[model samples]
Target chain A: MHIPDGFINVPTVVVTSAVSAGAIAYGVSRANRRLGEKHVPLMGVMAAFIFAAQMLNFPVAGGTSGHVLGAALAAILLGPWVGVLIMACVFIVQCLIFQDGGLTALGANILNMGIIACFVGYYLYQGVVSFWGERRRSQLVAAFLGAWLSIVAAAAATAIELAVSGTSPLAVALPAMAGVHVLIGIGEGLVTAAVISLVMTTRADLLQLERV
Target chain B: MRYSFLDQFSDLDSFIHRLDPRTKLVSCLAFILAIVLTPPGRWQVFLGYFSLLLILIIISKVPVFYVLKRSLVILPFVVLVSLFIPFFKEGEVAGSYNLWLWQVSVTYTGLAILGNVVTKAWLCVLGLILLSATTGITDLLKGLEGLGIPRVIVLILSFMYRYIFVVVDEAMWMRQAWHSRSFGNKGLRQIKTLGNIIGSLFVRSYERGERVYVAMLARGFDGKVRTLHSLTFRKADFYCGGLWFILLVVTGVFLW
Candidate 1:
């Protein structure tokens, strides 16, 4: 869901860019608290790992393939602050280095894929896992639902932005974006659950931050 | 990950490559803003935008075909998002189709808007591709930092660029191992193995993070990250940036 330039109007870009910058600033301070002297390398490495993992495509349904969005996975593995940082880094690299997204739309992309996905996914997972009791099974279910909902939420936000910009009317853009993302979310859910379950089974120690 | 995939042509010597990355970055942002602000159905303006980009592509020495092919990658996504607008938007009916128990009408106005959105998106992508194709990621990150983006964000981006390929190589090795062990099974079983692969990759990455930290410490890395500033704005940057700005303003004014 990398929204290209011209997908949203100039006013929308300005507003979202301001909001995104504020959110990122808050996330940075929060992340700084957790990132001590020793944690710097881990933070950097984790960001790189997320970037690398995104390049790995998995078979979804039919012959189609989907890559991990890694927002929920990052939040579950690291704290939400670090999760936001990682996603933001990935987005910046994609925009500047790869041209996968537009520079003018960077803040919007960060807000949608980084902030929205990371925060929403993290909180929803906490809520679900708490309700279900923190077992392996509960964590897996929570991961699946959290990942799926995060995609839906980001997609919906993108739709709203498009509508607000008058790029497309709400009636037309909302359902269209929401519909496509619902399917994408299924893949997101499955990958999220599978990775979490596998980690829980194999190297549970690596999920030390999940408790935080 | 193909590490060079993003900036494969960045090292090539050209006027565009030689300019300060900050200038290129700002000009790119300006170009996109101009494209977005242009009113719909101004076909002349769109042509002007495209022609301007074509000239830049020539000056940059990036192959026209490479840019064209790269720009097309955004079309499927553009189409997917905008295709239904023609059906749902109400206007003078261009065509009507009866399906099952309902009728759907396409509007001329909607089609025109759709075309405008696609064209605008394509032009914006071209600008982005040009910016990325000529500038290295490290320089771009430095440019971003110089432009007053927070240091923390810049540091994170630099780390991402430096180590992304190493992690990708690890992933490729794991996938190779998986393929060697398993074959002809494209079903549920493969997904489970895929999960195992991802889990293992994460574990390895986490451990490597610790090792990398140790190595940094050994090399006298403090908690604070620092980089030597190597970028300087030359007179050529001003000349090129001024010329581009004037072109954008001239094209923009011709519209009214």
Candidate 2:
């Protein structure tokens, strides 16, 4: 879902870059103010973990495999702001070092994957957990739905950007992007739920760590 | 154990390799931005950009095969996203096909746009490959830091770089263990097992982070990260960067 450079127009790039930059700057200041010294290493390590975890692909269907985008998982594990930071870092590294995404499209990628995914997944999870009571089952259910929707939401956002850039029309891009991601989102949901359950069983304290 | 995959050719000596990372980073961004902002169907401008990248690839001395292979990674995605454009776009019909109960037509404008998108994406990818293949990851991060990227981000990137391989190795081991224990299990069962592995990895990484933080505190690490070698832009940076920028501007003006 990483958008390449030419797929987006200049206005879209500039606007998205401005928004992402502002959000990241806010996140950095929040990290500094709220968590102080500990969050630096913690966020760093979590970013690395997310990056590496993405490499661990699981079999989906038809002999194909998919990996966790880790935005929802990160947001569930860390708070949304820190999740945003972690994901932005991951996107930047992927773009610069791995060339997995485009340089000019970095802002759009970050806005979709970093901010929108994390925020949507996180708030949805929080809302579900709060509404359903934070039992293990509810948390797992929340994780699943939150993760599933996050991917779809990011995909939709990507499609909208593509349409707005005139790369693809909304009539085509919307349904196509969202339709494919719906399945991918299921895999993301399952992995997210399983991972949450595992963490709940093994190291629940990590989940309880102070959120910044 | 082999972590060279990240920056395999960065150690090679060449003018591109030796140029300040900041210069390379800025040049790369400029190159891609120029490529992306250029109006579509400017075949000459696109060719000029490609030639510029080709010249850099040659100068960098990284294997041509490696650069080509790396740049091709974007093709499947580009194709997947834009493949239907030719059919969906409204213009002069290039061809029409009757499939089952429906008729589909491809448009000349749509095909042209699709081709233009692919070309732009490919040129941008080539520019990125040149930047990444020549500069060490460390130097790139340092350059980003030098360019006024936040200290927090730079630190996070550095720590991530240091430990990604370690985490990846652990993940591989866990996958190996799972493969040994499971016997052709597919579906939810497989996803559950993978989830457990991810959770365990997360826990281990979190603890490692704590340990690292404690170690840093013990070694007098404040909230600030300090590096000994700072990046400096020498005479070569200005000359090369200026020439490249001028070339890009000239191409944009004359070609446009």
Candidate 3:
């Protein structure tokens, strides 16, 4: 999902980088509009929380552990733009100081993990919850679907990027990436659902703020 | 309920750790680009790149032991995916072996490819560990927002970050509770207990999400995102970001 440097072709890197940059720039501006002065501190605290949570790796079938991408989780909690920003920060820091992702490909990484995951996951979640007609079970279903689709959507988006860049054949890129991620999405849904539930049961009030 | 895992190392004071995330992000991007752009099989360039990474790791003040441990964690995953590469990566035969009524062959190309994959992955992870360790999650979010990430995405991540520890704690508590109530040989019974716990956890998480949404609605969250930009770039941001890119270019152009 991180999409390191070498695997992708040069043209894809350049184009995705440009597109990613535009999206991130737009995201920050949008975040600025949404978050007020008071909400900043709260948002910061939550950001820290997400960073920490991402470290906990849930075991997968092949003995490889996959951690939560947290795009959907952030969307459900803070809203999507902020969620993208949060991940962007994490990825940025990871790339610069840690070199977890390629710098030239930063655009693609953010677009895939931050923008697509955050927005897609949240709307799906919000919609599913809304459709369930105020049922608690509806939230779970929405969360499950939102999370599952968010991951797949990100995979699909990456496949498109890979195709555009001609990094790998789309047929190979789409299924290969999506297939493994689909399995990973299961963990994503479960973890996302579990976290949202804990927050609601405990300090549920904090999940919302009075918008002026 | 709060946990940043190994990323908590960012708490330490260091010049590299304090630099803006964009600077760091761009610099690392440059580093990775340089590495990837370089054609494989240049052993010296790889060595230089590794050395460069080592220097950054040292400057970041992350415990070498911890970094090694963290890097090793990914080794298993990488090995699993790439293990087949060596077996299936047809090339000039380096060695052949017969065992268990099957003949196995090793190729130099396979070995080379395996090394390439492993090295690239290691360098990438090294960069991530440094970035995560030096920068606080909160500030990192601000940096990303400032850099042009989408808000809807930001919100989703913020929630995940906030509630992840809480969720894990819940699981731990539930496990403890399960242990206290049951007193049988730990096998299928334990598995069954685990299943029950997961089901219950799922229910609770679902309920919480609803309450959270209701809370969201109460706060004027109309399925729309809003926020103010707080991460104003300082002079240091420019200095570092610029210097890093320059360094990356130099390395890419000269070394490779």
Candidate 4:
């Protein structure tokens, strides 16, 4: 899911860089207001956790390995603004220190994995949980759908980036990426659900925040 | 649950590690752009790129073996996909083979593409290892926030970092439980036990998420999220960042 540098082309980087920049600016402003004093260091630690998890990829089909995205988990646990910020931090570190993703494609990766996954996944999770009465079972379903959609959304966004960069024809990149990613999404959903369940049981108090 | 793996190298004072996360982030991005944008046939440029990253790796003081091992983890996936290129990539056939009724051909062009993919990917990974080894993950996220990264993504990363150790601990405990109940990996029943362990892990994680959420809310988490501090830019950040960016551009232009 972390597209290394040069996978997409030049023009796509330009566009995505701008879009990602805009989103980050807004997310930071929002997070400033929402986060309490304690959240500063806490968020930093949480960011570190996502970085580690992303590094832990389990083998999946089609010769690719998938890992937890942590988007839905972030948003449902810490609110959407913080969720997006956490992913941005992970993307930046992965590129600079770990090189898991491309520098030029940072914007694209943020948009795909950061924006789409965190914000989109959080809202969807909230919607489902609220709709189903916000019980334990509802939380599981919300985590599933939220995690599943984030992966698929990221796949769609990457396909568009490939198309814009003119890497392979859209005809090739779109379906190929989505097809493989759908299988990947199943893994993401399960992992997200597991993490959410773990937090729910040990510190159910922490999750009560989502309900409020 | 020890989770020091991410920042273990961050505290070692070094020049490369001292640069602002945003600066290093951009430089690496440019390096990747240069590699990915180069024509596939430019084998020399790939060599040049590899040498460049290798030089940085040495300067950063991270162990050669560690970087090599980390980068190699990506090889399996790359090889899995690229291996088939010789058979599927459309071009002049290098050779024909038969397995009973089935016939297939391998093409030189496909092999070239495979080589191209592997080299580019490897070069990119080397650069990342240098970055990860030099910067603490926490500082890196702050730098990202300073550079206008969205809050939600940053939040997601934060939780993942804090809890990965906990998750690993849980896994360890589950393994111990299984080991205690069984004599060894001696039978098919062990496999079933493993499956049960995985299933229970999933359920446990799902429940844990709720508790974390409640903890967050107790701290006054409105739907809106906020951060407590900021990443301040320093003079070294500018000079080092500018120098690296210029060098990358110069090298990339020459490659072009």
In order, the Cα lDDT scores of the candidates are 0.82, 0.89, 0.65, 0.68
> lDDT tens string, model 4, A1-212?
66666556667778888888887777666665565444544555566555445545444546755557777667777777777777777776666655666666688888898888887788899889879986888898888889888888888787777556543446655677778768778777776776676667655676766321
Q: Report the lDDT tens digits of candidate 2 across residue range A27-95.
A: 999988998888888888888899989988877668877899999999999889999999999999899
Q: Ten consecutive residues with minimal summed lDDT in candidate 2 chain B? A: B80-89
Which scores higher on DockQ, 3 or 4?
Answer: 4
Candidate 4: lDDT of A117? 84
Task: Give, for candidate 3 chain B, the lowest lDDT window spanning 10 residues.
Answer: B77-86
Can you rank all candidates by lDDT, best first?
2, 1, 4, 3
Regions of candidate 2 where Cα sits further than 4 Å from its true position: none
True contacts kept of 2: 0.73
Clashing pairs in 2: none
Among these predicted structures, which one has the highest TM-score?
Answer: 2
Candidate 3 lDDT tens digits, A68-93? 77788778766787677666766755
lDDT per residue (tens digit) for residues B47-139 in model 1: 987899999999999998998888876766686666666555567998988978868788887788778888888898899889989998888
Better by TM-score, candidate 3 or 2: 2
What overall lDDT, based on C-alpha atoms, would model 4 receive against the true structure? 0.68
* Per-model DockQ: 0.66, 0.80, 0.13, 0.18
**Best model number under DockQ:** 2
